[model samples]
Target: MQLVSEFRPKTGDATLDGLLEDAMVRFLSRRPADRQDALEKLWDAFERVKTLEGSNKSVAVPILLGNAALGSDPFRELLTDEFHLLTRVGNNFTIRHHEIGKTPPPSDHARDYLFVRLASVVAVVLRHTGRMA
Candidate 1:
């Protein structure tokens, strides 16, 4: 099992924090075959935070992932590309919006990678928003 010691989000918002914690636990405990669902839940957690902050009204993913608030323009562009790729992977392969018969599920490594990346982004958002000390 991969250890996710750094997958911590201190958003100070009960709902968002709870979701992040639940997703972390699910990712840590679930088997590889069951991890795709966990990844989707993790992405949902991030989305929930974005919605809670009222930052995703016009955007698909969180504005933090694409906005200048994250960093410089080049860095924001990179993060935005990464976020979009992650979203596409979730929608195309994972259980997020894929039909069982139409799309192939992601492998264990892919799921793990997605979880880690999402966790990192969530942590960044928390830190950026002064929710984490």
Candidate 2:
């Protein structure tokens, strides 16, 4: 499967779009550091996109995700779960920070997996909120 291609969507917010674009560009590098950077930027964008709806972060996330409005209950649950998982990975890993106990992604495959997984949810939220097109 393709992680990123020529058809990346616009996130409307210039900063957010740049974050996503930069993440994709960084992911193109073969270096492990670059992949980690990609996840960092993607996660940053993910947090910022949740606030686009004028609601507080906690309230806005569910609105941004949209409850059962995308298609069905399963899809909604999947998206919500994915978002939470991404957030947890960011918090627990060395992608964002390297303080004391955070662990870096084990391999190149794992790094790539993280970048793509996080980016997917960020893109979906942007699209659902009309921030992406």
Candidate 3:
């Protein structure tokens, strides 16, 4: 929880930031059940990347590739049951987008629904973060 609150996206690292965005998009587009199975694997990869401190981006790249190959884990459970990930991503994206203040796409309604779902997850996550973090 606290980890997520503290986890501002690392924009300075353009490559890593792009990878994270791609991973999130992939996860968001997946089916719920498959997302769950895939999320465990994705989380595992993130954990692995955290440890690849000295290996340079090459080490992380494979992990990112593995995550991309695994596909998006739209595991709402991770947001509902877990915490940090959804809230941070949601809150960050919400704030980030608004700050940039771009208009929603042509599919604004659909995008809104997705954003709402993601926000709900973020709310749950924030509560979890308050307790756990």
- Regions of model 2 farther than 4 Å from truth: 1-3, 67-71
Better of 1 and 2 by TM-score: 2
Looking at model 3, report the run of 10 residues with the lowest lDDT sum.
Answer: 124-133
Q: List TM-scores for all candidates, in order.
A: 0.72, 0.86, 0.25
What is the C-alpha local distance difference test score of each model?
0.64, 0.75, 0.38
Measured by TM-score, how close is model 3 to the native structure?
A: 0.25
Q: Output the number of the lDDT-best candidate.
A: 2
Best by TM-score: 2
Question: Model 2, 48-85: lDDT tens per residue?
Answer: 77777654988877776773247667877888898788
Q: What is candidate 3's lDDT per residue for 1-133, written digit by digit as tens? A: 3322333334244454444344344445546543332333333334333333335655643343333333435543333233345335433443223456443333434444444454333333323323111
Single out the weakest 10-residue window by summed lDDT for candidate 1.
60-69
Clashes of each: 0, 0, 3
Per-candidate alpha-carbon RMSD to the true structure = 3.3, 2.1, 14.6
**Alpha-carbon lDDT of model 1:** 0.64
